[model samples]
Target: MPITEFLTRNATYFKNDVALVEINPEIKNIPHVTWREYSLIEAARGGAFRKQLTWGEFEKQANRFANLLLTRGIKKGDKVAILLMNCLDWLPIYFGILKAGAVAVPLNFRYTAEEIKYCLEKSDSDILVFGPEFIGRVEEIRDRIPRLKDCFYVGDECPSFADSYDKLLNYCSSQAPSVYITDEDDGAIYFSSGTTGFPKAILHAHAALVHSAKVEQAHHHQKKDDVFLCIPPLYHTGAKMHWFGSLISGGKAVLLRGVSPEWIIRTVSEERCTIVWLLVPWAQDILDAIESGRVNIDGYELSQWRLMHIGAQPVPPTLIKRWKAVFPHHAYDTNYGLSESIGPGCVHLGMENINKVGAIGIPGYGWQVKIVDENRKEVTDGVGELAVKGPGVMKCYYKDAKSTDEVLDDEGWLYTGDMAERDEDGFIYLVDRKKDVIITGGENIYPVQIEDFLRSNGSIKDVAVIGLPDQRLGEIAAAIIEVKEGFSLSEEEVNNFCLDLPRYKRPRRVIFAKVPRNPTGKIEKPVLRKIYCGESVVAQQNEINIK
Candidate 1:
């Protein structure tokens, strides 16, 4: 089935149910305004807005947008790039593109003008639909993208060259377009975070998205009454796939604009959210706030918040331990997936296997995982790269056949660059990224192990371990830590905390500094490596210092 069917089915069967709730305080008191009015208001007072959409209303708006796209000559195989933050209209706009039998290319809201231009040109997106927050960036690159025929503004104001989203919707028909969309048709183009270089576009079939929703629903077992709290950007597959569970179940979900720990807890309480998908940093922040008595957990009614899942990066076992201590009754799950495999849920730590906290758990529903060596042969025990075969796997990297072939095999297995080990019980434990393994004197050291250990220390707020060049050992582990507010830790204290670790496995050099992380909370190790290890000779010097 086409991915848009999820919304269509929900609208038909559960028309009265709440589908999406957007909580943004910036636009709370503002009434409906036109493009010119919005521009004036934007210039006079900068603020945000909120919106809510029921199943029926959501479908109606999507249909209206679909009709608008159809009327504007968008057809099957046409690419529509979406540039928006998390909002009520995000999904409607996405499903509208699908309903029109067009492909949706979602751009990262944090992308620079050059990056946005590159994505637009590379994806061959014919139309660009962007939110107001990105107006400046869009304007910077608007004339550069030659193939971009139209630009639709989603907020109250539309520039002279673009069309107003609300006005266009009002003028279009509120009936679903009679388009023949199929499972094999192109659905979305999700760009990979360019840790090493520029982002690569990973294209997916409509079937992949539909399969993801089903897999999410099966794994999480979401009910219609369940409410999902979504805090991450909608452009990310992690957040969207997680919300697919609630969408498939015809449940409600809240798009929370704020990301602070207090904001998350308050939104969960106010919305009575049952399921929340969080990244490692936010989870850690919430735990730290509660532990420090900055947040009074008893003050909020979080009884309805039953399940909490973490994804996007390696979750430290210590963070989960603290969470369990606070919310003992809540179920915990962890998902592992890459953009090539259609986001998280390819491998999942089932809630029942809470005892196996460190493992990434088994292959998800209808998914197969294998740890393979350099020769492409499966490894039964030792560490190797993880290869996944599943329905949700991407079709290929858009216009990059060479790069696609490097990762994906002809037999439908995606060779993930993550190194992992399989235990005797068949549970998979992620060692580290293939490129991130620090080899010192022929002994391999995974940074995740060291980072997890250091996170357990009370003084450390966040930590990242990177391999710095060492003259004697070739390469040695270095710990870069972000100390918690109101806490102090010297290099000796940090080294003493890791004394129990094997000497080779322990960090040889310790530095006090802020741990650099992306919006998704994954540490930017390349950035750290560049900052700390500028040159080969500089990195060879073993020293402890504060930055």
Candidate 2:
């Protein structure tokens, strides 16, 4: 039941059909958070890029890479790490490793050199396949990592230290490698986004991968004619699992490179995309553009677009309200899950239940959900940690038994760190992250509650709430607001906006600053905590709360 079987089936039935499209936004401002992203755009520039891959070509490329790995002495259960951006070769390289009976380990493109070395050693990876953007980083720690025996470059102008991926693929056969893979076999290892720069690896069996595809297709009801537009980095779970819906139905997909509202609309219009998976910030930007008249709705061919779903963070209900107003015919959903649960779809908002807009919805297909308190007792009406049980749950934290036992219990439920409350109607509402809770004067303050309130203001573009240490109250809530462009906002204005909130929950201080988010669009509160007050201080406070 390996996920590769789906790829093979599609190749058999839809050999000439377009399976993937790489939409390149050259010289366009694709939003970036770090200097490393600039290097990727430069390396990926020019006319030599492979823009599209048919189902047949995609399957053959995977088989060729698998054949090359088998010839290189790779064996079953060996680890092959992939460090590449979202491109035509990214998925081929990933599927190639799985087809060879080797575990596919995907590293974040934003990872530093030390992180790359640490993950390689931690997962016991023997081979590395990377794009040109990571050349200097790989070279920086080449001699330092003794476990890595081979490196393959996916771009042009091969370096002397690594073999050329394209050249090696041409030399190998396109036939499938001789490997016996089963549902229970370990298939992939995904790393959690460690805000502290040290990520924890999560392992999953081939069964989990297969289950993700089934769940995606069942939830979204994808068809052969539907085209999916993917915008996020493929290394993350959210983007890849969403694309699984297309794979299950032998449908087409577009790998969009940019997040600008203009580029996204243009790609959807030209590609005739029927489904789109977007993050919270990207959806908000699109709405702002349409409202400000910067983007005319009548300009694009959007009648075919049917569904738009978002994930990776708590989606503000206001955003969806604005979206439904503009595109009344479009059905929207929001998914909730973590790396431990094989991406998303364990819990999702059903399109039919549009009235329950603020809730994250009930358990997904073949999944069960519940809320439990600190003592492991189920809480029906109160806020507690959200837990889910499903086939998509990870086998364990890779090589970290102690950490795995902390979150996963013997009953088979994966305890998500998100605090939530189930309403009388059985829909669940996410309160906030458990670790992000602020304690001031023995009162608990969830940042999501305050952040959602601030986002309702038209003048505020984005916002984040964090705790700063207080000598007497122990800690105090601080709001960092990002005002909309061309709109002037003041501390007095924000304070006035908070008069409706309870006195204890109001932000103790107001600071105007641009909020930082990771690649998945989740606010980097730990980064904010470090900038406003040391992260160590917040960590110490949480430790005291546990006591």
Candidate 3:
């Protein structure tokens, strides 16, 4: 079925039930305001506002938006790009595009004007629906996108050149459109988080989205009464697909406005959230807060918080161990997926196999995963590239045939660039990105292994390992670390911590600095490499500080 049907179904069955709740402290003063009032307040004071959408209201808004798109000549297969942060309008706008038989393109809210323009032009997007936060950037690149026919603003003030989202919704009917959206229709274009280079537009069908939601629901086992806490940007597939589990199951979801540990804990307690999906850094931050005694577990009624899952990066076994100590009653899981595969849950670490903490678990529901060598032959025991075949896999990278052919094979398997190994029990352990491996004097070193080991150090808060050019050894390992606040670690101390590792695998140089990461919490190694070693410049042999 088309993913929009999920919203329609939920609206019919749970009309009065809350579908979404947006929590923000800025909205504290504007309680019970109408949509227009909220928009005006938002325009004047910015997006510090609280809002809630019942199933019925959510569907009605989506229907209204679908009609608006239809009125503006948008039809099946047309691209409608949405650029907004996590807010009440994000999902409704997404579903509306789907219900109108249009392809939804979600741009990263953090994209620069140039990046935004690139996506719009590359996707051949016909319409741009953006928020106030992106006004300056949008205005800067607005003229560059010749294919963009219409611009709609989803905030308090609509620019003279664009239409107001609130105004359109008010004028349009709440009735569902007559569009016949099918499962095979184009659903969305989600840009890959650019770790290596410019983000690729991963295009997916409606069936893929439905499959993603079904997989998440099947694995997490959400009920109608369950509440999911979502903090990540909806533009990301990880956050949206995770919440789809709740959406498909007709459960409530809370979109948190802030990222503080106190805000998350308090919301889980107050909203009685049952499921929460956290990225690695957020998970670590939450654990550190509780361990440091800054957040008292007893202060919140988190008894209803049953399931906690981590994704978007490697799941550190140690992080889970500490989390279990505090919330022993919670069942933990780790999900693994990529933008090309439509988001997390193509492979999942089931709660039953919590003992295999570091592994990403077996293939997810209706998905097949295998480790393959450089020749495309399956590797039963050793580390190789992880390949996934499933209904959730994207049709192709939008408008880029060469890039698409590189990753996707004729047999419909997506060759994930992640290097991995499978255990005797069939659990898959991620080694690192195939391109991320450091080769020093013909010895291969996985940065993840070193980063994981260094993370165990009490003085290091976060760390990223990268390869720096060396005159004698081609490339050598370097560790960029972010020391914990008020904590100091000497280069000698870092060296001593890695003394247990083999000489070839140990980081040769140490630099104390904040480790850079993208919004999804994946280390920006390319950025790090650029900072430490200039784009074309190599490090001098004397710069290698190995003792």
Query: On a 0 to 1 TM-score scale, where does candidate 2 land against the true structure?
Result: 0.78
**Residue 276, model 1: Cα distance from true site in angstroms:** 0.6
What TM-score against the true fold does each predicted structure earn? 0.78, 0.78, 0.79
In order, what is each prediction's RMSD in angstroms? 11.4, 12.1, 11.2
Which regions in candidate 1 have their CA more than 4 angstroms from the true location?
Answer: 26-50, 193-196, 436-547
Task: Tell me the tens digit of each residue's lDDT in model 3 across 1-547.
Answer: 8999889999999999999988774445555544346655785865545568999999999999999999999989999999998898899999999999999999977576887998898898999999999899899988877889999999886888788989878999999999997889899999873334456889999999999999998899988989999998898888899999988899999999877797798779878889998866677678779889998888788999999998766665767888899899999999988888999899999988899999989999999998899998998888899999999999999888988999999999999889899899999998767667665543346677778889999999999999876543546799999999989999999999998665666899999999988999988887998788773243343443441
Candidate 2's C-alpha runs over 4 A off are 27-50, 193-197, 436-547
Clashes of 3: 2
Write model 1 residue lDDT over 235-335, tens digit each, in one string.
98988998999889999999998778977997788778999998776786788799899999898889989999987666657668889999999999999
Per-model CA lDDT versus the true structure:
0.85, 0.86, 0.85
Give candidate 3 misplaced runs (Cα > 4 Å): 26-49, 193-196, 436-547
- Candidate 2 lDDT, tens digit per residue, 1-547? 8999999999999999999988777644545322234435555774422267899999999999999999998999899999998888999999999999999999988666876999899899999999999999999988888888899999989888899999889999999988999999999999873223246789999999999999899888999999999988898888899999999999999998778898798788878999999876678789889989999979789999999997766665666888999999999888888889999899999878888988999999899998998997998888999999999999998998987898888988999888899888999998766667675643446787789889999999999998886633556899999999999999998999998776877899999999999999999987897798875367656865894
Error of 2 at 226 (Å): 0.7
Question: How high is the lDDT of residue 416 in model 1?
Answer: 88
